[model samples]
Target: MQDAIYAPHWNRNAHSVICVLRGRAQVQVVDDFGQTVFDDELQQEQILTVPQNFAVVKRASNEGFEWVDFKTNDRAQISPLAGRTSALRAIPADVLANAFQLRQEDVSELKVNMERQGNTLLRPSRSSSQWRAIA
Candidate 1:
């Protein structure tokens, strides 16, 4: 796979185990306290566990990456924190603006930028230099 991000998301109903089958990947998982619980690069044959309800994001390296995902449930649902399907869109704009400590117009712009991406699996872009910086 090309350099891509799975996006920050959580599976409320199931835990998951991911095994890296090829290339390399960077994985980060945040706990309920909003602290990063795990952040590391994974190599071929490496495995990582993602507990249910924790938010996680995975980025494949520029060389590309592949992995097998195993979930506790036969059907798992994901709630993305950022993307067109993000839960943030469901919140009232005023509330979101207040929570983000931004002007309503700024919040609207943020929403627009997020929606413009339109993809849950994000491709690397010049604007996403920060994510690309991860080694």
Candidate 2:
């Protein structure tokens, strides 16, 4: 119904990977014991991942800026952005505009299930004798 707001605190389940389309987004990451570690701006076509259990902050670079925010089931307190750190900013409800927003379910379903080389879905390693030596 309304433009989406970036979560204020760190998310436990929703790992975030932000990709800017027409605008920009500032991704803020806080380290363990609650210290700001990452604060950077991502422009169009750039990709970044926020690992689980890390404090993250996202905000549009300018008014009407559009970007896609990927979220998972993990959730953080949905509150007005509150912090004095240079990396985080509280976006007023009016200026937060975007073309599309992906909810947790949408992101969860779209996740890539990459299997390792020797998992159940992959062939197990065979004995060295089974392989012909490279001649």
Q: Which stretches of candidate 2 lie over 4 Å from their true place?
A: 1-7, 72-135
Per-residue lDDT of candidate 1, residues 8-27 (tens digit): 88988999899999999889
Candidate 2: tens digits of C-alpha lDDT, residues 1-135: 011235445545567676677666666788656777788876678877766667666655544345666876545322222333212233322233221254544323222111111111111125522211110
In angstroms, how far off is 18's CA in candidate 1? 0.5
Instruction: Tell me each candidate's TM-score.
Output: 0.76, 0.44
How far in Å is the alpha carbon of 22 misplaced in model 1? Answer: 0.9
Q: RMSD for all candidates, in order, please.
A: 4.4, 19.6
Identify the candidate with maximal lDDT.
1
